[model samples]
Target: MYKLICIDLDGTLLDTRQRVSTKNREAIRKALDQGIEVAIVSGRPNCFTIRIMNQISGRMGHITFNGAYYRIANKTRQFPIPKEAVMKVAKLAQKYHVRTYFKNKNLSLCTKSDPGILDYDQFKSQTPLKDQMDMLYNVDVVDVLSNQDINILKIFAWDENLENVRKMREELKEIEGINLYLYDENFEMSSEDTSKGKAIQNVCADLGIQLDEVVCIGDNYNDLSMFEVAGLSVAMENAPRKIKEMVDKVTLTNDESGVAYAIENFVLKENE
Candidate 1:
């Protein structure tokens, strides 16, 4: 019997509109009611992850910042990049002229090409006005290197040019204290010891659950670590071919409520 379910947010649980479908939400609620623990594992910052979870249930667990931070209600765990490494990354990002977002457990900050245009504000506008206000209070545009109390747990950098992304990622790989994850035109950095797999192990340990009793569902390369550690791994139909090939099962697409389908057919059905 599975004791925990780790779901990815962007392309697994949330649809194209970035909202969890009614079916997905209902499935999650039913799973919770059935005594199954569900946790969101994503590369997003804590505030955004917490906001999304609040939409489904006020009480939920999350492994946020790509696993630099883990929290479930009052319990929490953090793996922060060393201050020296964070400064090195900030300097490198500035040198590369790539837009970057840096986040810790409580606050998030971003770099802007023009002081007049706040990239974070534009991103925040996608949420409700009330939530924007709440997020805004914790988000800021800043000269990242100068922030004495930055305490950054994760760094996300992007540029339109793939070459720039590739070169920067190569340099970042040389850094001793951080783990680098490269996507198409963006890259992420966190503590070397942090990953969704390790975060889930930590959460399971805290809750007296075992790794073999966990199930994970996701649709991207970042979710690979979770797959490696989970007892049952599921990929969305919309996921890349390699991702689908890696998982034990491939469910419907995010638009079709794939998470709900997987839980209903694989989890709930088996439990019944």
Candidate 2:
């Protein structure tokens, strides 16, 4: 019997329209009623994840920043990344003339003037950016600096030049303790050994649960680490062929409520 379920948000839980279906909500509620603990693990910040949870009155812990921070209940715990390493990555982003977004222990900062085309208001209605800024000690939107003094959690750069991102990944490989991942057109940088899998392990340990008691579901390369550690891994129907091949099961497509379908057909029905 699975005691914990760790789900990825964007492409797994939320449909292609970016909303949770009623059927999925009922499925999750049924699971919770059966005493199963459900959690969301994603590359998104807690501020965004919380808003999605509000729609269903769903309560669960979250692993955010690709597992850099663990948000459970209302308390947030962070795994600090070395300042020296953050500075080095900042310098590289500067060298390549790419935009960067970063989060430290007390603040969220970005170099992007517009934050791309993301609809911050619609996307974060529950835990708005203003709320996050208020909780933060400081927030800054400025030019990329090579010598910023910050203990970074994660740094992301968006560029059309995949080769540049690839080159940056290779250049940072010598940094010794940092991890780099390229997702779609963005490059994500984190501490040397931090990953979604490590974060899940930490959470499981905190709750006295074994890794085999957890189910991980996702649709992207960033989710691979979690998939590796989970006892039952699921991939969204829309996931890349390579990612799908790695999982234990493939459910309905995200457009067809794949996540909820998996829960209802697998987790919930098993309990019944």
Candidate with maximal TM-score? 1
Off by over 4 Å in 1: 113-147, 160-167
Candidate 2 on 50-165: residue-level lDDT in tens? 77777765566778788888865455566756776776766776666555667643355654353344334444446745335212212233333344545677776776567777
Q: Which stretches of candidate 2 lie over 4 Å from their true place?
A: 73-76, 104-106, 118-125, 128-150, 159-170
Alpha carbon lDDT at 235, candidate 2? 92
TM-score of 1: 0.85
Residue range 1-272, candidate 1, lDDT tens digits: 88789999999999999989999999999999998988899987755776778788866688988888887745788999888888777677666666676766645566544243323444454454433422122233345346566577888777666776677677787788989877777878899989999998888888988888898999998899999999899999999999999989999999999999999998998788
CA lDDT for candidate 2: 0.73
- Screening candidate 1 with a backbone cut-off below 3 angstroms (N, C-alpha, C), the clashing residue pairs are none
Report lDDT (Cα) of residue 74, candidate 2: 51
lDDT of model 1, residue 197 = 92
Candidate 2, position 229, lDDT: 94
Angstrom error of the Cα, residue 138, model 2: value is: 15
